[model samples]
Target: MKLLIVGGTQFLGRAIVTAAVAAGHEVTLFNRGQTGTGLFPDLEKLKGDRSTGDYAALQGRVFDAVIDVCAYYPRAVRELLAAVETKHFTLISTISVYASNEQLGQDESAELHTLTDPNTEEITGETYGGLKVLCEQAAIEMLPGNVLIVRSGLIMGANDHTQRFPYWTQRIARGGRVIVPPALDDAIQMIDARDEAEWVIAKV
Candidate 1:
């Protein structure tokens, strides 16, 4: 299968690309070419800027599946879907879309966080999840049954730029009194980058 991956330079995207390659599928990465440009030298790279809506480079190109990893707003996703409506679209959504303080083992059917204004430009950390919920809804509307929404939890592995879990991992590696946040053992679940990659590949 030929796959088009948006934002395939960073941690999770890189892992998905690697997994797709390992699975013997043709993979093309679409990004601004600012991060991990030196990593996948042999792979096909389609450069574009999502913030400024510069997707002219992707015109007339189609793929078996398009995995969107960097879209944060409804308009961003809407533009991409309008450009590539023929492909099976897989969106990388966050588990944070679920309402805060979720029940154990929530699935895709779980209630999502509320969004007052989906197109608002002032999206802060408090509104990230709600905005994502809006984005997911737009994706579903655009792609319908052809859309696969992979709700992911904390993603961690090499090449992680966020430094969220890696910080904790490094702290734990030191083997000292780690000042962890409250509810350290409260049923935390994380998806390894490789696992997420494999899952996406299989689904696609």
Candidate 2:
């Protein structure tokens, strides 16, 4: 299978690319050529800015599957769909789209956040979940049954830029007065980047 990956040079995206290549699938990366420019010297890379909605590098391109790991807003999703032709689209979404935190064992059918102003593009802590929800909705609307929305929780592994989980691990290793957050009973859903990548490849 041929794959076009958006934001394919960082963290989870890089992991997905690695898995795809290891599985003997043809892969192409489309990004602004900023991060990990020299990481994948052999794979095809396209230069363009998604924020500006510029996909000139992807003109007249088609793929078996398009994996969008960087899409965050509805307009960007639409712009991507308009730029490419593909049989399948996989959107990397977040579990934060759930509307209720009080519910335990929440499944895919759980309520998701929705934007009051559909035109809003600013992504803040207040709007991130709703923006992801909008992006998922847009992908579903565009691809219908061909869209795969993977709502992941905490993703941790090598090449993690956020350092969210690594900070705690390093702090614990330092053997100092590491301040641990309260709420030991709170549910934590963590998935390794490699594991997530494998799952996505299988689904795709």
Candidate 3:
């Protein structure tokens, strides 16, 4: 299958590219070419910037499937889908879209956070989750029943630029008692970046 990936140079995005290549799929990448630029030297990498809404690199491109990993606003998603053609569209959304975390075992039926200012392009802690909800809606609007939304939880694994998981892992490896979070009883949910990437390619 031919696949196109948006932002295929970082974290989960890099994992997706790796998984797709291993699975024998032809892949093309569309990103700003500013990060992990040295990686994936053998694949086709298009140059574009979503921050500025520049999708010229993808104009006339078509793929069997497309996985968008960097869509943070509804406008970006709408413009991106309009720029390319694909049989299936996969959006790498987040669990943050859920309005309430108090309820246990909530599924996709759970209510999503409402965006007070859908027109706002500013992405902050307060508006991030709501914006993602809107982005998901935009994808559905653009592709209808052919869209797949993966509301993934905190993604953690190799190639993580945040250095978050590595910090804790290295600290614990130092062999000394450490300060632990007070909420030990709280249930933690997360997915390995590689695992999620593999699952996405399999679906494609």
Candidate 4:
């Protein structure tokens, strides 16, 4: 199978690419070529920015599955489908889409955050989840039954550039007592990028 990955250079995106390639699938990456440029030296890299409507590189290209790992806005999702032709569309969504996180064992059917202003494209911490929700909707609207969305939680693993989770692990290695959250039980939920990548590849 031929897989086209959007933003296949950082964190979870990089993991998906590696997993897909290891699974004997032909992988093609589409990104702005800004970060993680040194990685995946042997694969095909299509330089473009979906955020700014720069999908010219993806024109006429078709794939078995299009794994979008970095769509922040619904507008970008719309632009993406218009640019690439693919049989299946997979979106790497976040758990942040939930309207409330206090509930335990919530599934994808849980209420999702809503975007206050639909026309605004500005992405900030407050709008991130809402924008992602919109992104999911956009894909579903375009592909109907051909879209799959993975509501991923905090992704942490090797090649994670954020380093927020790694900071705690590194501190623990230094032989120092670390402060943990007051709600210890089920206070945290995270998925490793590599593990998620493997699952995504299998599904694709």
Candidate 5:
């Protein structure tokens, strides 16, 4: 299958690209060429700025499936959908779309954030999840039944810049007095970048 991965240069996106290539699928990456430009030299790279709404690089391109990893607003998703019409569209959404973080083990049926007041600038934990919810909704409306929204938990692995779980892993590896959060025993679910990539590729 031929796959197009938007924002396929950072941690999770890079992992998805690697997994897709390993699975014997043709993969193309579309991004602003600011991150991981040196990596994945063998794969196709299309340059465009999302913030300025510049998608001229994808003028006459199409793919079997598209995996969006950097979309944070409904307008951005709408622009992408208009640029490329594909058979399948996958979105890398967050599990925080649920109304409250207190809710655990939530599935796709959880409540989503409103796009009316989405955060356009810097996205905090709260705003990021909310905007993602809106972005997912836009993609669903644009692609309808062909959309596959993968609401991911904390994504971690090598090349992770977030350093949320990596900080814990490093602390545990150092073997010292680790400061536990208030809810230490709370079930914290996470998906490895590779595993998430494999799942998305399989679905595609």
Candidate 6:
């Protein structure tokens, strides 16, 4: 299968590209060509910026599936959908879209947060979750039954620029007293980048 990955230089995105290549799929990446610029030297890498909606490189391209890993706003998703032609669209959403975390075992049916002003595009701690909810909704409405929304929890693996998991791992490896948060029995959920990437490619 031929796949087009948006932002295939970062953590999860890089994992997706690696998995796709290993699975014997033809892959093309569309990103700004900033970070990890020369990683995938063999595969095709097109230069474009989603912030300015400059998808000129993908103007006449088509793919079997598109994995959008950097869609934060509804407008950006809509613009990408309009620019590309693909049968399946996999949107990388987050569990943050949930309205509240008070309830246990929240699934996809759980209520999602909504912004008071839908037109507001300024992303902050307060509006990030609600904005993601809107972005998910936009993808679903635009793609109808052809969309797959993966609401991921904490993602941890190699090439993680945030160094979230690595921070704790290295700290604990120092072999000294470590400070842990309250509730040691708290259920933690995390998905490996390679695992997520493999699952996505299998679906494709």
lDDT of each: 0.84, 0.92, 0.92, 0.90, 0.84, 0.90
Model 4 stretches with alpha carbons more than 4 Å out: 184-186
Model 4: number of clashes? 0
Give the candidate number with the greatest TM-score. 2
Model 5 worst lDDT run, 10 consecutive residues: 113-122
Across residues 111-184, which tens digit of lDDT does each residue of candidate 1 receive?
A: 88986775684568878888888888899899888888888888887788899877877888989798877976
Candidate 5 lDDT, tens digit per residue, 89-187?
998887777776776666778776654455464577657777888888889899999999888878888889999877887799999688888887877
Off by over 4 Å in 1: 172-176, 182-185
lDDT of 2 by residue, 25-87 (tens): 999999999999889899989899989989998889999999999988999998899899999
Q: Give the local distance difference test score of model 5.
A: 0.84
Q: Model 1: how far is 111 from its true place, Å?
A: 2.0
User: Using Cα atoms with residue i matched to residue i, what is each candidate's TM-score against the true structure?
Assistant: 0.91, 0.96, 0.96, 0.94, 0.90, 0.95
Displacement of the residue 170 alpha carbon in candidate 1, Å: 2.7
The list of candidate 2 runs beyond 4 A from truth reads 185-187
lDDT score of model 1? Answer: 0.84
Residue pairs clashing in model 1 are none
Query: Against the correct fold, how does model 3 do in TM-score?
Result: 0.96
* Rank order (by TM-score, best first): 2, 3, 6, 4, 1, 5
Model 6 weakest lDDT span, ten residues long = 119-128
**Each model's RMSD to truth, in Å?**
1.8, 1.1, 1.2, 1.5, 2.0, 1.2
Residue-by-residue lDDT tens digits, candidate 3, 1-204: 989999989899999999999999999999999999999899999999888889998999999999999999999999999999998999999988999868889899999998777899898988988999999999999999999999998889988988868888998899889888998797777788999999998887
